[model samples]
Target: MQVLHLSTSDISGGAAIAAYRLHQGLQHLGVTSQMLVGKKSSDDKTVFAPKSNFSKALGILKPTLDCLPLRFYPGCDITRLSLSLEWLPDRLAPKVAQLTPDILNLHWVCGGFLRIETLAKLNQPIVWTLHDMWAFTGGCHYNQDCDRYTSSCGNCPLLQSGNNWDLSHWVWQRKAKAWQNINLTLVTPSHWLAKCANSSSLFQDRRVEVIPNGLDTEQYKPMDKRLARELLNLPQDKQLILFGAIGATSDSRKGFHQLQLALKHLSQSGWQENTDVVVFGSSKPENSIDLGFRTHYLGYFHDDIALALVYSAANVMIVPSTQEAFGQTASESLACGTPVVCFDSTGLKDIVEHERNGYRAKCFSAEDLANGIAWVLQDGERWQHLSRRAREKVEQEFTLELQSYRYSKLYEEILHFGDREGIKSSN
Candidate 1:
C-alpha cells in the first residue's frame, strides 16, 4: 500500500523524528512510504520539500506568520507563546492531490506547514499522529494545568486570557467548523495522551488508538562505557548522571528546576563529590548554576550515534518533564542499556517500569527523585541488572519493526473496512 506522511520537518523536532522513523520502518517492511515536509534536512530521496525559491522563502516565513494573530494579545506571556494561527494560504492541496496516495498520515502539521481548514480539502483517509495537545486545543500546544480544553477553551493560561471569547475561543471555533466532518483517525504514542484525546471536547467523538514511538536498535545499542567515555573525553572515575532535551535549562515544562532540587537532595547523602552531571542539547551559559556536583554541558548531539554514546557512558538518565506526549529521550536512553529515573507521571509511565528497568519516582517529588537516583547507583550488581533489563525492554517492545507491523495492519483495516466501524479501540 502507498502511504504519504505530512510533517513540518523531516528530521528536526521530536515529532518529525518519530514520523520519519515510522516512514523508514514501513519502507523497510516493503510498504511504499513517502514524506512531504516543510523542511528537509537529510539527503533522503524519498523525502520531498518545496522546490521553488518563493515556496522555500514562504516556508521560512510561515511559522512567524502563522503566529501573527497573537500580536493582539499583548498581555500574553511571550515565553509560553506556542500558538499557531494557520491563517496563511498555501497551494498544498493541489500538490497532495497530484501525489494521491491511499492513506495520508499527519504528524505535527502546524508551525505554518498545514492549515486547520486544509484537511477537508484533501478528500482522503487520514491518520493523525498527535505529538501534543495542539491537535485538540484552540491554539496552545501544552495546556499546562488548565482543563479548559476538556470543554470549550477560553481564559487560556498560556495566552493569559481572562475572557471567554478571546483568541483561544476563536481558534477553537475555527477548528470545530472546518474539521467537524473530516474523515480522520487519531493515534497517540502514549496511553496518557490517548486518555487526554478521549476526554477533550474536540476529539471526544473521534476514533483514538495507542502506538508507542519506535527507534533503530542497532544505531542506539550499548557501547563499552570506558571506550565511550574515552572517545567523548568524559572522566571515567566519577559516576555520571545524564539529563537534557530541547531547551533543557530554560523550558519550565522540562522540569529543570525539579532536577536542580533533586541533585541538591542527592548531594546531602554523601554523593556531592562522587557524582557528575552530563547534559546535552544545551551549552553552558555564561552564568552557570551549581548542582552541588560538577556539571558538564556537552551541548547538542548531531545524530543518534552520538546520543547513543552519551547514554551508554552514563550510569543513569534523568527525565523530569512535567508532561510529555511521549518521552523520546527516555526510550533512547533505555535502548542504550542505561537505567532511567523519571517522575511517575504522564507518558513516561509507559516507558519506565517501577524499580524494574528503571525507577519511577513519586510524581513531582524531588526527594523521591533523589532517592531513586541513589538507589539505582548504590549497588554495582543491581545497576548491571537494571542496565540489562533496560535494553531488553526496548528490544521486546519499542523496536522499529514492531511499529511498522502495527501501522501496516492499521492501514489494511482502514482500507478494507471503508466505513471502518469495528476498528475503533486500540490493537
Candidate 2:
C-alpha cells in the first residue's frame, strides 16, 4: 500500500509527531509512504521536504491581505482559502502525485494548505483525520457547539471584528457544497469527537471512525524523579509543577492566564511559597503576584530526553488549555509517572480519570483549580498512588508500539475496502 500523509507541520507537537510516527509505522509494514507538510521547522527539513518559497510566502501573505470581506474574523482566512485554491494544486500536485500513493491521508486540513478542493482531483482513496472540529464546521476550527455548522451558519458564535460582509453564512454554504462533493472517510481521534462529528449535518451521513492518538512510551517511561531533578538542577524540596506546549503561555486558547490566576489564588490561600512552575516552551510572567523567583523557565526544549526529565521531575503536570483536540501533554506527563490536572472540558475530560489518575477542576474556575492543586499536594501517599496509575495508563493505551500497531491495522482495512470498491466498479 502507498500512503501520503499531509499536515501543517512536519515534526513539532503532538499532531505532527503522530503523523511522523504513522509514516514510520507504514514503512515498517512494507508500504511506501511519504509525508507532506506546508511548513517545516529549521530541523524538520533534514528529514522531510521543506515547503516551497511560494507556498511559504502565501502562508504569510494570505493571512495578512486575503481578508476578502474585511480583516480578521473567526474562520476568515480558512473560509476564503479557496481564493488561492487554483495556484496551490498545480505546484503541490506533482509532489503529491509523484508519490502516487494508494490513499491520501490528510491531517489538520486547515491553516491555509491544500484546501478541500485539492483532494477532489485525486483519483486515489482519501482518508482524513479530524484532529479538530474545523473540517465539520462552517469555518471556526473549534465550534464549541454553537450549532452554526449543523444548519446554516449565519450568526457565528466565534466571529469578531469584520467589515460589512456577514461571511459566516456564505462560508458555511460553501463548506456544505465542498463537503458534499468530496469522497473520503473521516477518522476522529476520540469517541467524544467522533460522536460530535456524527451529530453534525456535514458528517451525519458520512462514515466516521474513532481512533485514539498514541504516545511513544519507551521514550516516556518512568525515569527516576530524583535523578531527573538532579540532572536538570531543580529544587529537591519544592513541589514542581510542569507545563508546556508549542505556544503554551502565549496562546489565549491554552488558558494560561487562567492557570496564572489559579496559581495566584494558591498564593493568596497560602499554598504558593513552596511551589515552583517549570514551564518548558514559554516563560513565566516576570511581574506577577502569583509567581515569584520560584518559576523555572526553560525556553524551547527540542530534545526528547530533556522534556522527559522535566515531566519526570514534576509532582503534577497541568494542562491549562481551554481547548485541546487531544491533550498530548497529559498523556506524556502520565507516561512519566506524573498525574495531570486539567479543566473538565473537551479533550482533557478524557485524559484524567478524576482522582483515579489525577484531578479535573470543577470547571475553568481559578478557585476550583487551586483547590485541586492543594488536594493533590496535601496527601503524598494518595498522590503517589495516582502517579503510579498514571504510568500504568500510558503503558496500556498510549504507547508507541500500541499506536503503530493500531494504525497498521486501520491502514490495511482502508486499503482492502478501497480495493473491494474498485473491483465492484470494474464489474
Per-residue CA lDDT of candidate 1, range 1-427, in tens? 8899999999998899999999999999999999999989989999989988989998998888887778777887565577777767877798788787898999998878888889889877899999998989888778888888888898877777698988888888888899887778889999999989888988888888898999999999999999999998999999999998577666778998889999998988899778999888878879878787888889888699999999999999999998999999999999999999999989999999988889999978989999999999999999999999999999998999998898999888888876453245853
lDDT score of residue 126 within candidate 1: 90
Estimate, for each residue in 239-294, the C-alpha lDDT of model 2 and write its tens digit.
98777846644456787788888877877776667778887886545674345326
For model 2, the local distance difference test gives: 0.70
Give all TM-scores, in the order shown: 0.97, 0.86
Best-matching candidate per TM-score = 1
Worst 10 residues of 1 by lDDT: 418-427
